[model samples]
Target: MPLVAPTTIQKVSGESQVEVPDLLAVEEPLEIRLGFGPTSNRQQKSVSVTMRTPGNDEELAMGFLFTEGIIHQPADIVSCRHCVQDAQKEGNVLRVELHPDVIVDWSRLERNTFTSSSCGLCGKATIEAVRALTPGPLASEFAVDAAILHSLAERVREAQLAFAYTGGIHAAALFDANGKLVLVREDIGRHNALDKLIGAAFWQNWLPMGQFGVFLSGRIGMELVQKSWMAGVPLLAAVGAPSSLAVQMAQEAQMTLAGFVRNERFNLYSEPARVRLAQMV
Candidate 1:
């Protein structure tokens, strides 16, 4: 699917008026569904309707299922496909079939499903609600030099094919402990972008990402910290600042959080020990 759509608009400078064409990042709604049980008595249900940039939706839905605590492991999913008769609605809906033996948590699906591009998590009621979702402490002793950390933004930017075209998408990338780029995913929503990255790792059976670090294109939010923590990603760096709650959560999870990673400098908001300075022999 094309990531950019052209739209015509009028430009005004003082009293002067000019018509021009503008490129917009395509935004569309995706409905995620769940299917379970035997062939004879299967149950299909609606899960969520999220606004996304219209690509890598299977990974998006799977990522949503994992970060939201809906599915525990990849084995819980039997199959995933876009299920719509009309071509117009094909990419808008994705149905994930679960293993017959996997239990479906119906109550978890009763919340609001309309996710805007600005925020993906809808019902985080309180700080406790977020704290309750925290995963165990990360097991990796991964450390990177401050000099290397500041360069992550450029390395991630170099790999963003979609952002280079639209100039309006958020990106999440995974880097190895040595600062090598592993993979990247982009979306109009920050959370969705991270989800797509995580979902790809899950599809490839790369869970418990103890050997990986995350680099986000936007600010560090609590949910982003939470999601990466759940996946056991030990270090997260971003080009923007970290929220108070995000810093707190990262500290609690024993994960390193860095922000303002640009111009050869970065602010370590949590677990500063993970960012090492080069030692002289």
Candidate 2:
């Protein structure tokens, strides 16, 4: 199905009234389900029902599981497929089959399809209660030029085919250490976009994404930082402000966070060392 829909809106600025065709990003509900045990004895359970833009559905599901701390390794997923229902309903449900040995920690989960600030525990208490679910302090040696960081927003913008048409959608992209964009995903939901990007990596056996940087087309929030950190991304840059908790989470995870990346100016919130500025030789 097409990711956008056509709508007519009346333009009434002064005395003139004209109907104009406009494009709107399609938002729909996606049900994510989990199946465990051997194929002969598996049981399926509904996990999340998220409203998102359709495209890269499989990648979005995988990324959601990984970022939510539900699945740690690519090998943990035996296979993923859309539900067996009809076309209209088929694309709306995603089922991920897990290996028999992988035990899903249902009690420790604090999963969501949106939002990025709190991981069940909020503020200082988050450090104690939820940090165990995330990866340890990053040891990635990936670094990029500050100039490169400053230009990342445009790089992401040029590749945003969906945002270009709908303007109402959000985007998340993965860039290699050389400042080249490697993967891009767009959705009406910001977190969904991030999930699709990481999920693509998961399907391609590209976990431990410390070698790549993530760029967002919108504001940096606690959840985006948390998801990127969980995916092992060493650096994250966004076009808007980062929440206090997002900055705190990034610093605590030893990940570099940059915000307001546009017009040749950007702010570094944590792990500034990863952004190298050239020195006069």
Candidate 3:
């Protein structure tokens, strides 16, 4: 619901008739604020703000924190709430408070000076910067069959209600070990969709998804891979292509990455060993 935006469009007919319809789109903006820990004096000072669709904002904040390695466990987060008490003033701001003993690394916090829905790595200095910040690669103990990967793509597509109505939103979904869809979120920006999904999982105390898989309604990119890895999800499936960097990161992280998932077929990019093709046979 927060993804809707007001826009005017002209519809022209063959003769000369014109019509205008309000357009819906995922909202994007800067949400600058600071993160505080209840017990310690440390806090993320002068954090950059980014605008986003208004729905599931709590999840977005939590997911962002998790992906950025700000907090490892759900318990580390003491609380997350709107920065402003008044609804009218808190339009897009959220404040995340962590437990006092939780580690607050200033060096890592400086990297995220600016963020955008389209590009998650908006403020990084270099490719090396990404490599340096990469979380440990996922352990290769999880098993995900090719059939399950194929099935997940269909499930993600089926869950896309907003796209059905507006034909212009992306979706992100999480599935259990058995490939049953657990949660899903949609937004105009692919990154925001994933963030919302992550936020939802965080709120539900579903971190370190070692036994779960992530499915995306669009292409799998480096940012998507990074988010899944940060959440400890061992597998990622996308309906479209995988960027070259995404493939590289998945391989390095030991995550099972799949793309072009449709109609019972998909391309596996990394950790194919975990995908049992014969399971379908």
Q: List lDDT for all candidates, in order.
A: 0.82, 0.86, 0.73
Stretches of candidate 2 exceeding 4 Å from the true structure? 86-88, 111-121
Ranked by lDDT, top first: 2, 1, 3
Residue-by-residue lDDT tens digits, candidate 1, 28-139? 9998989987777899888788899988999999888887777878899999999878688877889999988877766544432322222224323433454455556776
Best by TM-score: 2
How well is each residue in 1-281 modelled by candidate 2, as lDDT tens digits?
A: 67999999998988999999989899999999999977678898998899999989989999988877778878898889888776778688989999999888876555343344554455657654447767588889999998888888888888888788889999898998788989999999998999999999988888889799999989987888878888889999999999988888888989999999999999999999999999989
RMSD of each: 4.1, 2.5, 4.5
TM-score of 3: 0.80
Which ten-residue region of model 3 has the weakest summed lDDT?
114-123
The residue ranges of model 3 lying beyond 4 angstroms of the native Cα positions read: 5-8, 12-23, 28-32, 37-44, 85-89, 112-135, 279-281
Per-candidate count of clashing residue pairs (backbone under 3 Å) = 0, 2, 11
Candidate 3: residue 235 lDDT (0-100):
87
